[model samples]
Target chain A: MASACWGLPDAFCQFPAMDGKSLLLMRRTIDGTFRDIVRSWSGAIDAATAPLQIALNALERAFTSTPWIVVLALVLAIVWAGSRSWRIVAGTAVAMLAIGWFGLWRDTMVTLAMVSVCTAMAVVIGLPIGIAAARSDRMQRVINPVLDVMQTLPSFVYLIPVVVIFGIGKVPGMIAVVIYAVPPMIRLTNLGIRLVDAQVLEAAEAFGSSGRQKLWNVQLPLALPALMTGVNQTIMMALSMVVVASMVGVGGLGKNVLQAINNQFFTLGFLNGFALVAIAIIFDRTSQAFGQRLQQYRGAAHD
Target chain B: MTDQSVPTLEDEDEVATRPGLEIRGLYKIFGPSPSRWIGAVKAGMTKTDLNRRHGHVLGLTDISLSIPPGRITVIMGLSGSGKSTLIRHINGLIAPTAGEILFDGTDVCRMSAAELRGFRRSRTAMVFQKFALLPHRTVLENTRYGLDIRGVPRAEAERAARRWIARVGLGGYENSYPSQLSGGMQQRVGLARALATDAEILLMDEAFSALDPLIRLDMQRILLELQEELHRTIVFITHDLDEALRLGDRIAILRDGRLEQVGTGQDIVLRPANDYIAAFVHEVNRARVIRLSAVATPLAETEEAPRLALPDRLVLEEAAREMLAAGAERALVVGPRRRPLGIVRIGDLLAGMVRPSGRPPTDQAPTGPRGKP
Candidate 1:
């Protein structure tokens, strides 16, 4: 039924009433008989969602409960480590501090935690699927349409099913964000591995590299830049989901921004919106910079 | 004909004469279902007819050659001529649609996955056209990759790789990545990598094609020098005739999925098997290819020539120069250990050097009628 939740709204949105039931029956059987399918997960949802719910809650609390100074220093240190750019690190520090001054610091951390967890989960799940799709034609054919649907589906559409299953919390909100962010990683990873030089692969085969050996030693190393780009896009996509997902009781910087819209307070909306943008800019610039470094390293390696 | 000699520890020299690799009745058809067209192809259907009727491209058709041991067998052809396809079959990179690739006496096509792995790791190594070095790895790492795949201990593989790197004249650049090297240097890394594996057979598929001409020549000389001592069975693929002539003890020419001719370099140039082959050989510098023994008169009872003993394998150009310098009409063409094999007259050398002047053959000629497009 956790799976059925998404199928219900998908069917509801497509036909509402117009289409026939062969497709309907197919959907029904797939998600378990359609009649009470939505309700089937009510009992099981709590247990099934427990581990993830707890994990995300702890993550959100960890970020929000930390003293402002320690979080700021830790983040700046990471940014510096990755890019080795004092300017960028300084910029990130200023941006994070500005959010604190705007009284949106706690909410900002929650949003960051949500985005981080979802994007991590997306990559963790998507990368293997991408590798599988790259390796086998049959798997690619099967994964292609599923990815197409996943990518093209509106970010808001999956929220309905997520809300039904996880019942309007950090967990469901994360599910929505992950579903939105995952496709790019999958597509780019598949494309990257597929685009690896044919002759290089032949060289590996000529050297008697086992399939696993070839993937690890040759394919993955060369695919790093493109995979990093995929990661960048996934991070951006997850960030974009914050505002929409907050409607499902996801308390964060998004919820603050939502309230600004509801209350029609110009200053509130502007400040909170600015905070969101700052966070986005921090992640986006860092990821893109890291990706550029990877590209540069890769360029040195190519003909 | 085969020696069929059993291995005796006493005669290590006999091992060098046994055939290292053999391709028998090889056919490769490219399409959705190649098996459907294999029968028609084996019965001698034209490549065009097969493609028109079945949409299957004929890549290689009935390629058979006995590649002699410890010598270079150059498979030469223009692009789309299946030379690449033929080289690939040697190391089992491409499985023939139907044929047996006999390595030593065993059929490579019949090898199981494990056996194929063992064969590739222990018997054959390859150099690629584009110098396919792993970009991220340093030159030393790239050189050690073949041995690494064979599960050689890191220290020993690195030691062997270092020696090969220096042999290819890339001694100090071991720590640099492949990207840091020039084309010639990169190819050196590629060559070192292949050689470091210590495989008995080396498959070089246009390995020097991408290098500048001077560098290409340098690499050819390097390979020749190395082969002098190593005696590895090398299957070298090339589109360039001169390179083929210089390197090949035996040359097999292919055109559009069919074997045009297979013979020694002199046999190819002096007596081409067909008109198409005649055209391929026509523009080639024949004096550089024709061996003295190829044009030599048998040692007869008529006249005792000046005692200018030359190796039977000296090319016509070199022999011509030697003969003209000595002001002699003929010279002794000596076999192994100076046993007189035959006599080569200067006139025979001059006759073989003349360019073939004639029309191209019109019957069953491959690619098209006039030979040259």
Candidate 2:
């Protein structure tokens, strides 16, 4: 009997696969092309992103230099404005005070600044793309797979590309955080817009609403709840990236946690981790409350 | 052309003066390439056959109708019969795969995008079955939506919206959101919104169908009362025969996306065009729909006309009631200016109320027309 049972060569009996050498060559080619592009375009890219860096620096400086009491009061006021709940405001105040008690207030503020900047940038970039996807099936088809990859790929994999392109700094770290965080914003916005009542849209069109008018007047208003959820999710994701972002020379609670880890300071690591959790809770509660407030009209009792 | 069968304005001069919508040879095939299948459809491919062969759903086929200006033309059909699709075509919300929608000698189908926008903004407004009011907008704001789209000044738009809101009997609910109101009230807001636009054409797609029966009757009365004053060319769509009979100055019946018949309520109830239409009208309350003129006998020169007179436009049910109340066995059916057009007896009125037992005569049949004694 022949060794090849299916009447083929023995080589065909094994699964056809690329050898390691060919795989390595393909990877090298991709890496080399990216490196060349970064070498040629680094200065131009830095200039383009200078405004983002400036904004981040300004926010960080403002948070750090401001009196601790003033900053605490401001945070409480914002929580109050968003939630209109004394309980949430008191909880946020207690968390902030606890962080300050641990001597990590400044680091907490720095992380907050970074998360805020990343979130704002993600929203600004994601909203229009999401709206485009909602309006066109072809655009949606193209965007959905990319969104899936961005969401499912390990966060560290894209950080390498970010480091290569922008070098180690706050801007590159912010870029990495946005890349890891923006899928929810884009996905929810697209879903929200697509889910608007078709009959309502028909009424809008029947009334001769121009496309721009419909988007501004009908779509955005109806999609506000989902968009707010997207904002909340982006904030949470950006906060989670703080520890990862510290590897790029970011100075924040994440940096302290990294140092603690290296030195085996369990207490210090836990303290910094608690501070991060505090910030996340405050943001999550405030944004959720604000989102609910925006949709108050939907809850009115029928007469 | 079957155009003669369509009811015209009583005064021919008014027909010439007002530019009504004339939909000619309209065919809408819903598919990836709708225009490509228009030839096969026009060649008399049945809706089902076309769908089975080409995976193209027929929305409307060969719909030719002349909607008289300043009157209600109700397009009646069951669900999936393309009544909604046909109404959408009137406002250019849905473009026909093949046809011309003529208004004021301008082909609406051929209008540029900007021109169509202008036409919809300035000439037409619509009410929906589900009352698609913006949930976030208050009654006042929702009512002003159309005017806002038209770029009307905010103050002026609100003023007009307020007037119509009050006109629709939603006087004190201006600040309430749509979710805060009942369905009937929300539909009132929808009506007010359309009315506030001051558009000449009002397209109401099952505007009252979602309401309870009593509320529906109330809405129909309100619509008729408003129509008496406004006289906008209203195109109403409904699956309810009773509603169609109540509202339509001329009724058009549709089946499987095809135009089955077009005429007045009396024409449809007394003389359906085919068995399909006859079956549709079979269970309708005929006495409430058929007017006395349809069943009245021509006044003979040798006989005396009855002293008790009723308007020829009155339905048999109402005429019978009036005759019974007056204890009269007979009445003269009067036309405009109390002119005696015919005579109707109580026996004939009672007989007219009952559905014909045998095969209902179609328009094309040679037998003498029933209900025209």
Candidate 3:
């Protein structure tokens, strides 16, 4: 089959006689563009390195060689502030300190920053698109199939497109993180808008509301709780992407875990993964709790 | 036929001040078929018989009635009787199949889109059975929503809404969302919204039916108060005859997409034009419905009559109350200008305890002694 395709092109070249020169020119242009693309990738990498180094320095200053007692105390303060359970807080503090005693805090902080940045970008881009999709049937028709493909395609498949578009850097990793995390917000927004009561819509119409007025006054406010749930899901998904994204040069606890796997350091890899899970749990709980609060306020206000 | 049965206006004030709304030969037909086939089928059947055979599902048909200004005309019917469909036609929510709806002598069916919209915003307003209050808005906001659509400034519209809300007896519920209010309260919000527009005609379709019984009574009283104060021409649709009787100055009874009769509440109850109408009034308490006119016999001359004075048009019960109060054996029935018409005695009341039929006097024995009116 390969030989057959090559023969067809070669036959065309023979027939045209000028096809050879055109093909040569096409190849040259392709090569020039590829070089330009490579140079641009290198420049972006150089620019991105400063931020990465600065982040690493911050992590290093915050966690590296810090006394286990102080780190434990900070952990206790966080756990106490969040859960408010003294025994659980004490246990968490001891556990975090033990991980730091094993020298894993710097790696955990790097993982935290990568997940935070990825989650933030995903929310900023995904939310407006989700809102647009909710309001428009045409937008939904265009977006739904794209979201289906994004969700069902293998996790590793996202890396190929991101690598081609962004080249090997933290930005490519960020792209992969965004792709993996965006579908939930879109789906949730669609569901929320669809779930608004028909009687409520009729009431708005009876009030002489214009289309825009109805959407802003009734639809968006009612959908806020569901949108918050989508945000929470997006954050969890971004956090889940952290480990896989590190393969494209997103250095973090994910990188440490990968190195530990390579070096047969079982305890170090397990600890880094544990820290990732903890951060994911914390974000997930906080967002879900906030969504519930929003629901309560909306219900009381509506009544 | 000319309405020879309608008595001349006793007082000039009793005549309609304005020709409120006039509808002419309204027709609404659904489904698409060649007219040749429909005409062929319809040719063989009278409309009522056709409706009976088909189960009468197409809402309004050939409805023509006028609502006089400052009068409450109740359109009474069971479910699927086209009352709601008829009201919807006035605001152009549902266009008539073929009709001329004249709003203060202007044809509504001929209005341009912009004109129709302005007409709806300014000339006519409606309250629905479901209250149809915008759920997200406060009572005040919902009340002002129509005014807002009409381009009234925010503060002015809201100020107007506040007054109307109080007028509808929804006084302190200004900032509360619909979900926070009871069904009756929500309906009051709807009433306020419609009234705030200052539309001359108010169309209420089963407006109080959704409320609890006690609340329904309360709302009905409030509605009567509003009607009294404003004297707006109101077209109230309800299945409940009691509600119709309590509120309507004139009542139009509809059955199976047609108007059976249009008359005063007393006229319908005491003098139904047909058997279907008779059945509607069958359960009504005759004592409640009978006025002095129903049993009154015109007084005789030649110095042989008892001296008592009564108007011929009052209900029999009301006449009886007067007879008992005045301790008279017979009451004199007077014509419009207080001319001596006849007499109504307690014996005449006893003799009238039989069914009223439109057939000649030969069908039953004489009620006491009949005399000319």
Model 3: residues with Cα > 4 Å off, grouped in runs: A1-147, A169-182, A241-303, B1-19, B22-59, B95-120, B149-151, B253-263, B271-274, B287-373
Better of 1 and 3 by TM-score: 1
Name model 2 segments beyond 4 Å from true: A1-33, A301-303, B1-16, B292-314, B326-348, B354-357, B360-373
Q: What docking grade applies to model 3?
A: incorrect
Instruction: Name the TM-score of candidate 1.
Output: 0.86
lDDT of 3: 0.72
Task: Provide the TM-score for each candidate, comma-separated.
Answer: 0.86, 0.90, 0.65
Of the true interface contacts, each candidate retains a share of 0.64, 0.86, 0.16
Candidate 1 off by > 4 Å? A1-35, A295-297, A301-303, B1-14, B17-19, B292-314, B318-352, B355-373
Q: Give me the displacement of residue B219 in model 1, in angstroms.
A: 0.9
Return the lDDT, model 2, position B120: 90
Q: lDDT of each prediction vs. the true structure?
A: 0.84, 0.89, 0.72
lDDT per residue for candidate 1 within A1-303, as digits (tens), equals 436567665665454564586878777786565335657757787788889988988998999899889999989987876777788998998898788887888888898889889889999988999899999999999999998998888877877777756677888888888888888999899999999999999999988888898999899888888898899889888887888899998888789878988999889888878887888888877887777766563567545
lDDT of 1 by residue, B40-90 (tens): 888888998998988999998877777777788888899999888888887
Ranking by TM-score: 2, 1, 3
Best-performing candidate as measured by DockQ: 2
Residues B1-373, model 3: lDDT tens digits:
1142234343325436555788887766444432322343334444554346554334566678877877788999999788878877777766776778997778888887667777877777778888867665789998997798778999999999999998887889898888788788889898999899888788888989888889998988888777745778899999998788777778888887788788777667655666777778777766645545656764455646667777654556677788899998887776444555667789776544444645424443222111101
